[model samples]
Target chain A: MDEETAKMIADKGAWLCLQPFLDDEDAIPFPEGTPQRTKQLAMVAGTENAYRLAKKHNIKTAFGTDVLFDAELAAKQGKQLAKLQRWYTPFEVLKMATFNNAQLLKFCGPRDPYPGELGVIKEGALADMILVDGNPLQNLDLIIDPTKNFVLIMKDGKIYKNTIQFK
Target chain B: MLFLYGLLGRAQETAEKNTILIINATVFDGQNEKMQEGMSILVEGNKIAKIAKTINIPQTAQVVNAQGKVLMPGLIDAHAHPMFAGISQQAGLTSQDGYLNLVAAKTAEKFLMQGFTSLREASGNSISLKCAIDQGLYLGPRIYPTGPMISQTSGHADYRPSTSIPYDPNATLSYIERSGHALIADGVPEIIKGVRSVLRMGATQVKLGAGGGVASIYDPLDVTQYTFEELKAAVDVAETWNTYVMVHAYTPKAIQTSLGPG
Candidate 1:
């Protein structure tokens, strides 16, 4: 259906199932070398190409994280890929996974001088928060490591995985 | 054999008489380094055939200088947004079709001048433009392009609200090509089929917007648009055809939602 129809469906409070890129007829083919390779190196590499698509389409995107399934899985594969490639930083990778995404989602609140109370450790408002052993504000991977930096409990939320502590 | 010799002789006569022995120039051979300074590099037939510390040069071999300039393999950006002479800035308003070919032509050249020997244009409906550059019809960098991005309605790529005025309804379709971007499909089957169509048209990589855009009117940016199964289905189809998917998202929810099981 055209965009108007889709919007109409959405306006009525219906969920719209979305598709991915590469599915567009307008997508340009990958260049000449390795033309035969099936794997999408650009996506896995998290190259600027993926970022450009996100920019142009105004869509939120990560290197290959969006296409990958699990957060931990994305981190694992992303790390492995970066390691084999030998030129990626884990911090940058984590940033792409967290804050960059937060920016796209407009989640962390406004751009004002620290909505200081927004993501702060307060009680009444968003009791739902994550408490990690190691500082995730510095390294994103720590958020995932149950051993390195275990997650406590969801203050006022449902927990999918059990909470654990290190020390 | 005679034809080959004749070709070589003709080449030898017209070619510059510079038998340059690049001694110890650092060469980044993609994988590793073979750094040996004293080795002499021979230049014959436009190719480096041998490297010896001491070698007898043909009387016609002209020795030149290579004091500096490390010979590391050229770097690759893998991605870029090239701009041209007049169309560098994409902010202002202009006739859409008027400069279509021109922008395509110049952007390709800009990519080359910037030393990006090969590049991947993330998204655009410019396949023919890419073909023109590929066939040497124009001067530009080698480009692998994804013609356009696929997004859902009122989704990250939906440009309706932004393009619309407080009083204009017809403005809807006007911005479809620009903001709604290209093929915005629904559900798993349609998504799969859409990807196949792009593949048929020469797409080397697939791109998708799995959540609301950074600037959406209805839902929050982090609001998930496609379910994990949906994205996985798209990825599966792409993989079957020898391609992969790239999703557009910013929020952790969007990222975590769109990408699954790695």
Candidate 2:
């Protein structure tokens, strides 16, 4: 492992995007003895290895989920993020998803449809953001169930959700 | 009618008050590593006005006491089929447009209530549904609609009966196809035309069935669909419209074939 090369890539603002939650062992529909099962196992190993390498080299990381075909699974995206708790600290995972991912999106350059700054809050940054009910840094699992934990959601300065009405 | 109108007008007047102050909350703020405890957020109109431990709360502004609750961003579903309602393919052949739209609307509301603020419609006809939501005629999440799933004959998107002949004028279009849910195109010209038609209908992206599926009657899971030339035509049309194509493929061969043309 080329530690210098990994550090160079990190310095160049490259992000190691990982989706460990996509490696759902139980979701493999194939029979246990089938070749498809073997392939699924290999995929799980690959995902774990990628995460390990990124962490070992202190590489910049980003979070995403490649959910498709199943609506039930699609709604479990937050659970997928929580699954990362097996490998990372809650704060590290949150930073990877928010700060690191936003930095990577900037690489889109001209193709970036959203011109405003994202994934952060500042005086002039984009108003797209969220507010959770629990301290996620202490308990990452709180993010797994958004309906119960997410008390407020604001996008582009508008409050789309507010469970506790002040009126 | 006059009395009802007056009540609604008053309700709208109150709902239009956009200043909101959320206080005594633990703020995630999306990007920050540390959570700010006992913070206050002031939203003026649709934008966040201020976030501090203290802010001058306007008398007219709505004030929400967070009580140390966690506040975060709404979730986003990257791949969602809001139009699908779990009916059998054969049953879909008999379903009407009204029934399908109602089902889609219900699904959309479910998504919104579940805290999903945005959805990327994967492989269904949802442009009209998206429009209805955007126009405030329906309550749902923001949608990035893919008009329809394009597939080759006997591909994953091919939900037609086995007895139906290919491109036969005597045989009417399948309910799914007629309802703008999927299109079966065999050749490059047909693929290009189908892609363009969907793009014209305000599709932000194109979804093509580039592989077989378990639910599909004819195509086996291993079989690859859509030749390189055919896939290229769809890609070309999508690129012309400043969008991209997403192919539904499980097998490596199908994925590789789809990647070949792009």
Candidate 3:
């Protein structure tokens, strides 16, 4: 498609979901030079290209990690987002994961299960939120360990967790 | 002394209201370039009522001084398999459904505590687990279940014993297959039926084993599993139901074959 068309869709909030960590060398446990490993390398290159193109065209982007099979690896999802810092600023990565992804979910139309607004802190928005102990924009590494960094979690306006006393 | 006690009683009465006010928080707002500090957020009945540098606190609102904590939106996992529960493949064959469900329940809560508010189930037996959480029978993230992974005989999802004959009416399903975790289907018609069965079981998406897997006992890493016709049939059924099909494939050829002309 033309740049003009790309910009038009981006302006309306089209999202390009990027998962750089999926292509990391450690992602595939196969031996080096194996067909599976080589394929993973190609996949990584493809992902990098897609990221470059999205950035060049100013397409709206979102963070994603297609982690499956291993629960241990899946728990490290935050690290996947931090890996994006290699090609993007921490602030940009954070925004893509939150606001941009939220906008993308709106494309689900009537199939969207959560009807209320999400991915932001504003009046009338759904209160599905988290409280981090440290500023992630300044130190994205803090997000890598949710247990230590995330002090509180609130979903649907109900407090699921609160480490600090709040009476 | 009597007037002071009465005033204290009134204050306690106000605190009983369900409103919460969080102040002195370094709010991320999930979209802003810079973190806004010393902000106050008002939560009323499960929705953000107001957010500003200063908010009027009601007499009954429970106020929390955040001490400059970073506040942002809850995280999301686009691909997850909460039902897998880290159990060994051999153990999976022997474990009872009730035991497996319990493990899934624990796994789901752990995900929520880790700040994942929502997840998309990649495969496994997650339909009932999703229902349990949605119905308030258990605590978990908002799940988008795929039900089971569909595979051709000896494909990536095939966890059957090597001796088990394919498409034998007299033979019973393997424990993994009998557990609603996966389906072994071959040919275009079987693939279509498999896709439709999952859709009927509350699946929002379909997962097809379109390539060889490292864990498969029979298929090699380079082999493509389902034919284009079989893949197309699965996709067509998914499309008819307003959903999409996701395939498990790694190599270039396997991935290309899945995407070919379908």
Candidate 4:
């Protein structure tokens, strides 16, 4: 993004739904000079600059991973979030994924399908939460291995996973 | 894996008590930067009833000791394609008999297990899959579906080969179209219809292929799609239904052109 675009985003109060997609283990390599490979490189080359400009202009940013046609890439969702630590603090990264992303969802207004508070651990909010084995803010990389780190996952107050053993 | 599945299954059975008290948790409430240590939370039904340093645990509540672990709101993905995320390109176009959706279901399950509670669909036919997840028949994130991305012929979303050319209106829809993957729409009337069609399918918003896309082979990355009238028609239709349109664009001209309409 250029300064002008970043300024426009800030001026319009628009949310920059940004993703930290990189050429990592998640991506399947395309042969050189193919349309897919050229496009992928062009798409990725702008990401870092976009983030810096968005932050410099204080644009409202949301985190996402636009994974498609790749199951292996889909599994790296947490790693993508962790990748944000390069540009933001661990707390800021979590906040972007949780709070900021939900703000964009809430922007849907009456069209919101699951109408209720989301992406917050507060009284009267929808009971969507994750119980991590370790403090995520201190050790954000733990999220990359969710099977062992995310001990419990809850949505709508339902326990979808509870790996914790109680005596 | 079997033993863990057994535990998870048992947890589900007991989790229906509608009230749960999580004690001794390190709280990182989404809005706050500071983390609270040794906090507790009480959930009643599908909402958080209380969160404080201490809570009087009801005898009926299912108490879980957090063991001072961190608790935070589940993650949300602003742009995702749950219906297409886990499948290969070949499988996306060739796999028959609902095989793609089964893989999508697995992807959704993994999404939740990895702590993503909600997903906003960027483009895909996700309504039925979302319904199944909502009905508790499958495990996945809460989804807001867009049905399909509207596109013009030779635009970003076109999936037709040269073999199926000459633009025969009476011809049968392509497999991708019939399966609700993409809508090849052009002109004002078709744009309006496409927007309304997705809304009728319960799309939270309409998505438009307003420019060329990387995955779209036919159009170049610099090409801007949808004339002013057509883009305006889509926006007008979406507004009539009290919704909006989201476009996929990558270039200055493409972005500026769509911005002109919306």
Q: By lDDT, who's the top model here?
A: 4
Candidate 1, position A162, lDDT = 26
lDDT of 3 by residue, B93-208 (tens): 56788887887787788788878777667688798998888787888887777778998888877878787864578888888888888899998888888998988888877788
Best of the two (1, 2) by lDDT: 2
Interface DockQ per candidate:
0.02, 0.24, 0.35, 0.72
Clash-forming residue pairs, model 3: B14-B60
DockQ (C-alpha) of model 1?
A: 0.02
| Candidate 4 iRMSD, 1 decimal | 1.3
Q: Candidates 1 and 4: which is better by TM-score?
A: 4
lDDT by residue (A1-167, candidate 3, tens digit) is: 23443454355444445567454543735468765566555556556655666687787766666654455665677887788887888888777777766665554334456678777888898888889888888899988888888888888776778887865
Compose the digit string of candidate 1's lDDT tens values, residues A57-110: 434333321211122222222232232122234444333432232232222122
Error of model 4, residue B11, in angstroms: 12
Chain A TM-score for model 4, please?
Answer: 0.95
The residue-by-residue lDDT of candidate 1 on B200-260, one tens digit each, is 6666666677765422344454467777767887778777765566665544466565546
In order of appearance, the predictions have TM-scores of 0.48, 0.74, 0.78, 0.93
lDDT, residue A47, candidate 3: 64
Model 1: lDDT equals 0.41
RMSD of 2: 5.7
After TM-score superposition, the amount by which residue B213's alpha carbon in candidate 2 deviates from its true location, in angstroms, is 2.8
